[model samples]
Target: SRSLLKLLEAKALIELSNQTKPPQGWPSSPARNLEIPPNLNPDQANVLQLFQNQREQKEWLLWGVTGSGKTEIYLRCCIPELEAGRSVLMLTPEIGLIPQLLERCQRRFGNAVVPYHSALSEGERLATWRYCRSGSPCVVVGTRSAIFLPLPKLGLIVLDEEHDSSYKQEAPMPCYHTRDVARLRQQQEGCGILLGSATPCLETWLACQKPNNSIGLLHLPQRIAARPLPPVRVVDMRQELADGNRQLLSRPLLERLSGLAKRKQQAVVLVPRRGYSTFLSCRSCGQAVTCPHCDVSLTVHRNSDGHSWLRCHWCDHRDEIATNCGQCGSTAFKPFGAGTQKVLEQLELELEGIRLLRFDRDSTRGRDGHKQLLERFAAGEADVLVGTQMLAKGMDLPKVTLAAVLAADGLLHRPDLRAAEQSLQLLLQLAGRAGRGEQPGEVLVQTYDPDHRVIQHLIAGSYAEFLEEEAAVRRIARLAPYSRACLLRFAGPQASLTASAAATLLNHVANQLREADWLAIGPAPAPRARVAGLSRWQLLLQGPPASPIPLPSEQILRRLLPKGVHLAIDPDPMEL
Candidate 1:
């Protein structure tokens, strides 16, 4: 408060005004000002040149490879607007990015950074909001929700990891895309929107080419150190198992990982999901135990003392393990697939005397916990780290000489158009984790389809070519920036009511925007149709180039939903 008041004092906006009020004034002067180091690459500087807000309303898309320093590029553009005394709103798709981003912004910009994410305490959020509204907070770094932070002088908006699904709000009003929101806000406030990604979402790349809809294109094709993209070898598990090599880790990867661990170099293990076991299925009847409260499977995890416990993945409910299957009463229940926890157990057996750490939603549940765990890992207290998608986002480990994806096809089968793009992004990011400080990193992807085109493209390090192919597929499918796409989801206790309302809304939407030649799909049951005791129905809408669907997503949802029903709109949904 004192620092803010001092900045205001320097600007002559506020006088001492008696030097004392009952309780509403300065505490002390700014103590020990913080300095922001200039840590941006030369190519990122070139990007700042094109997007200085004096140029045309061109929303430039930057594609930076992993370990190529993309976050540094974002800060480069944000610095100028901040210096100009106008607020900067930098939106990130990942919730975990809040802390690292906020610390960097605060240290660099000093107390000017007001972070707003779900992680903040209620008091912190409210205080931060008040500060932003007063026009004193120069930088507002946050997750997708920060889009609504009151900032009239907001001059620059950046969407980092533009391809990530976290940008699309799953519930509540304004279920809008941060990228789209940033673009609209840029127009509303005359700011520059910089979209940065290692593997640019296919839709954004396609939008860059379309002169009518896009601003311009900026590409950073190489990593800062010009390090060769890691060598990616896709192991065919089918072949391995066929040759009687189904011992969990493939022979090639196991040998490589062993050698790396022996040298005391760090290793990161990427699994498809968290938990020890997602479900206990009876091999005979093929029925898996499920949560009675929600329509999702429960995960099996060991307690701190190492006893079995059945825990719901959706709800936090827990139950004692069942000796027999719930339906068949068969004693043949077994964990069919492996998660990070299960893999960690197996790794412990093979690689003894190696310190291992696990990072996932379960482990990093609180602020101090997250910070302490990261500090320990960064300080080399652990050798092998196993994690879920959280491993791919932040937490760069310089000594990580090897990164192994326990299962590469984990995200490949999702019913989303951007699944391939996301897979490539994860592979690129995970591969980038290795060889950051010159020790030469290695990435091993174990998949059945070793010759898949996505694997081939990822291994070749040709995301541009992959983008072209994915864009063509999208064009044929009539989705995304080629044609605008939005997903409408409805959930309520009464299944029929929710389905009926969503169907009615989509029908109304189709008639209102439907043309003689336009194309759209959905008004159907969503993938993972039920969550947390709610039967969910979805609508997928599209419009042609001549007819753009007016997206009053918030208004439309409010109007159509039953009073008790919940509605959400995901513009440019990563998951369909």
Candidate 2:
């Protein structure tokens, strides 16, 4: 080995080396794929066998719809790895659900079960990360970034909710989809990979299409009761508002909520944002007072300074509430949008003596915040929970028989093209939260655009129809799940400088990028456009090649940059 190394080193192609092999009898095993539980579905058995028998590729998209018993199927795939004494990392959308997943992992693996999440202290996270690497047939339950967890014998990787946008990492190091990263790692290490979701991202589905099919597609569509999907009722908000329904709860929804309460069934009111008011807008000028630091609108929050602050959402820039509107210097300013706090106040007045719980970044800021709130809600201590998009992921509650999307319209209003897909996913996921137990569940979706295709499809429970319509738009617009996207953002104090830098950077990118092969948009200023006093500008790139090209983002940083500009390359960005 030393001689071989010396020969290779002489060729001047060496950086560093830490070659090692698995422990004795570590990975040798005859195919046990057919050993699936006798009662397991044939499709489930096929999925397991694909992992056990197919070694040519490392990734598998287990496209199981809600209540498809995908979790059980995932368990089947994990059996072989566990038997071989290898570790598994299961990634979920949020840590709020981590405890629930941990319960399942523990129930199956007992003391062998291990968990990791951002909510854990740094030391605890580090310890668990180290422990997984130290060798154990452990299962690590965590959020998207948990893909980086180092395990000595990684035999299987499972990404629950593969289509969920939370898989797109926004901060910290090695910012990449836990799903994609897991696939890469599995390939590198020759382990099996699984991507599970109720609404599989088109990218994953398309990737698995036969070569003649790019990859393979698998499905588990029916509920485990195999009971039917819950009934979804769409309430048009336009007419409801014209009748003077202030907080926008439709009459039918109010009646349903009353019935649920009387039946002792709890419900959820979903408000997609936190805080009282996102911004103070001028009634006269239609302009909002924004934060100078971030390239976005300022949030009006009551702070300890004895006054309200216009706080940047991305950074810590703050300005006291304005006496005059910046646009027209109009004194007639008003809170234009509703957040969780506003929704909470309205729901309290609208409903009877219901015990309400609120969940959001602000509410879950501390270490144990997520755990405590989730526990209380799960224990049925809260009759109603009001929250931001934080509550829109995979959370199971048997008693939550009714879910009122106080406003589903917010999902449609986004700079992202996956807005419709995201909107549908959130609607379905939130709706799934209801009727888990014996009592059936119902969803009340209040949307002004009731006729929108996505809303219509969700209301009718026609996922296939929705996919076809959505795929049409994506193919036309070159949006995702069909192609890959890279976002480059430049941020700094001066808007002009940031814009100039961003434009110049975009020019360089346009020159370097293969024009005929890729799509490029902007060097335009970002939507939020500023944060914590830094002006932000962005460039969005879309590619459809068989292989992804590493974006030239860092190279731009290496080049001469405008003084205060910053750069972020978000592949498959969730937000603009």
Candidate 3:
């Protein structure tokens, strides 16, 4: 090795090596044989026509059902703008979707598609930035952070999956949402803005309802080829236990999986959480083992070799699994809930011939991990895929004949107002992943509260019905859509400082609220009361629709905040 190194060094000494540089400018060649689809559905055609003719419409919301051709519409809308010598910025919520989106865009626009995200190396990002500044028309697809890019002659902005909470940036000053920022940009540039989603955020829906509002709504109620939505079967866990069946897979789901495996089809099992067991609890003392850094219990995780550990979801802190109760020193502990790992293990045991693949945070840790796992599953390497909420994103897997929610009860009982709405959207989206091909699809949702509103809505497959009921409740309660709300969060290492700061802010806001139309909710603990060793508290303020109220200035508020306490202001946060 030393001789080889000496030889290589001597060879390099003859001439200094040249440093490689990133590619300059965009691709010169046009897209290779890119052609438009032969035809569009009537709903799709109508929406495209409206967008093309109404150049005056600054903001438009496209509410399409899952599996509907929203991306196609976005591509179609960009053609005219690109041809007119204008650029387009398209945003999605996840980095996992970037590769697929980039591929689609490249097929049509070729090298004009520049991807902007944190994952890009500094040189790559700088090159893309320089290329965008060259006054040439191109398409950029990226996550929320892409909204800040300086694209000259920007003609159109598209926010695909706009309802996703990932669009919101919580950290840093001037916290804002991409959808809102897109609207602001549309106003400034006189460019068309399009927000597409299967489940529209309530605020956007309400804006569309306003008679004088500038936002317009376009609906695509049918999937391509008029394929019927998969039939959803709601399985009551209580009945399953009563019938002497105690397993992650409900009876219907297990039967469907067996059938799929026999027929050489694929399936996806979704669990909202990622660890093996949700948490460990002492059977003797009935006390749950909680995280040292956070208020929540530590989840149980297992490796391929079967060693178990406790991990906090919020802080990513890990520790050894407790063999005995910490408080009473009793050697009686049990797992209380299930996550992706547990479901994966159960499926391996229950379905003998099934080739199972786990697709969660742990399994997808390496670079390009998501793409590899998805491709493996897509290639029919796995008979069933088990994962978390990441599986519900806009993944187009056609061979998946079955999709199952191992536990829907966990999603239904969140402390947030959008719980039911989110739950419905997740179920519908997961179900939509199946039956995309010639074979019909089936969905099985197992939940303790089978009669819950979210479960019932999923079973009925009626988003409008669910939204109407939720809207009425929000109206009566003066929640979002009926009013405007903001969350002020304070977190610090010291609990007293966090609490006191939160209380002081709450009182300050309360004193400013003279009219009954404005209200302040609390200076109470945040839903995630403590995370990463920081104690958290929050205060929520709500104002009536169309009402302007005076409040503390950002500068004054920051100066008044206690030292060591960090403040984050989220306007219209998806969660409280």
lDDT by residue (tens digit), candidate 3, 1-576? 767767878888544454434332235665578655558989899999998887777889999887888989999999998999999999989877777787788788877788887777777787777777887898998889889788879999999888888898887656788987887787787888899988887778878888886789989998888887899888888999999998777878777787776787899999989988988998888999998989999999998899999998888888997677988999989997888888878878877878999988889876667878998999989998999888888888889888898878889898888988888888888988988877888888888998898888888888878888889999899787788788888889888999988887766667677554678878888888999899999988888775654477877777768888998888777787
Which model is ahead, 1 or 3, in terms of TM-score? 3
Clashes by residue pair, model 1: 36-108, 58-215
TM-score of 3: 0.93
Candidate 1 lDDT over residue span 274-312, tens digit each: 888868788879998888777778888864467877788
* Cα lDDT tens digits for candidate 2, 1-576: 888878879998775576343221112343233323437666666666766677666667777656667887777677778888998888888877776777666556555666677676666676676677888777777787678878889888888888887777776534577776876796688777778877777666666654754355667767666656789888888888888976655788767766655688888888877777777888898888766654467777653343566666677676778788767778998886777777666666777776788888878777667778988987878888888776767777778888888767778877676787778877887877777767888888888898887778888887766777777887887566567777777777788887788777666666556754777888786776655666778888778745475456476554747655667667677665
Where's the lowest-lDDT run of ten residues in candidate 2? 22-31
Ranking according to TM-score, highest score first: 3, 1, 2
The positional error of residue 293 in candidate 3, measured at the CA in angstroms, is 1.4
Candidate 1 root-mean-square deviation in Å: 6.4
Number of clashing residue pairs, candidate 1: 2
Best by lDDT: 3
Stretches of candidate 1 off by over 4 Å are 1-45, 48-54, 494-523, 545-572
Best-to-worst order by lDDT is: 3, 1, 2
